[model samples]
Target: MVQLNLVKVLLLSNERTGDVRYEIFSKEGENPDYPEKIIVYREGNIGEHGERG
Candidate 1:
């Protein structure tokens, strides 16, 4: 698989209200099945009103 470059990973929120987004980052070569130790990052909480929380 190709290595992810951009830290931001756009995705539909579980709420499914609208275009909510987040960012994820992990160490290079880290396996999801056997991750020894990895770091993660998530950003923002936008509501229907389009405000950061």
Candidate 2:
């Protein structure tokens, strides 16, 4: 026998505004096990005002 599970997630960005991101995850089997997952949607950058240093 096999089992499945579904997961949904939403992400939003304030810098751009009105922008959103979506993600979905699925697992198989009754006792599915996996390592942690990391998602980096944004990167650090100098603001329009310019860097202080």
Candidate 3:
């Protein structure tokens, strides 16, 4: 099994939509358990019924 080492991480935000996107830096490889990019919504960004923009 190959292990990914954390090199750096950045949290970028979209001013227009107020959405936060995170970038994870690691040794490039396939990791089924984790994802490379992730987007998180602000407090009012997501709807009550789990809607997204």
Candidate 4:
């Protein structure tokens, strides 16, 4: 069986909104179709200072 885990981190800014960052860590062998590596996913407004949902 293959197991996958995900970690999410929130980055805040000085404005009014921030960006949602995601870090994906996997422990799998390097495969052509399923290559194991560190992936980063970011979205939303960056450099914002406020509460985020």
Q: On lDDT, who's better, 2 or 3?
A: 3
Candidate 4: residue 8 lDDT (0-100):
34
RMSD of 4: 6.5
Candidate scoring better on TM-score of 2 and 4: 4
Query: What is the per-residue lDDT of model 4 for residues 6-34, given as tens digits with 9 covering 90 to 100?
Result: 43344544333335454544545433334
By lDDT, the better pick of 2 and 4 is: 4
Q: Alpha-carbon error at 2 in model 4, in Å? A: 0.5
Scored by CA lDDT, what does every candidate get? 0.47, 0.44, 0.51, 0.45
For candidate 1, report its TM-score.
Answer: 0.27
Q: Write the per-residue lDDT of candidate 1 for residues 1-53, one digit (tens) a residue.
A: 55643344556554343345544554456644443333443345476566645
TM-score of every prediction relative to native: 0.27, 0.27, 0.36, 0.29
What ranges in model 3 sit over 4 Å off?
Answer: 28-44, 48-53
- For model 2, the superposed segments whose C-alpha errors exceed 4 Å read 1-5, 15-17, 30-53
Cα lDDT of model 2 by residue, 1-53, tens digit: 43445455567755533335555444564322441332334433356664321
| TM-score-better candidate, 1 vs 3 | 3
List the RMSD of every prediction in angstroms.
6.9, 7.9, 7.6, 6.5
Model 2: lDDT to the true structure:
0.44
Q: Worst ten-residue run, lDDT, model 2? A: 31-40
Evaluated at residue 44, the lDDT of candidate 4 is: 45
Q: What lDDT is reached at residue 38 by model 3?
A: 42
The per-residue C-alpha lDDT of model 4 at residue 41 equals 48
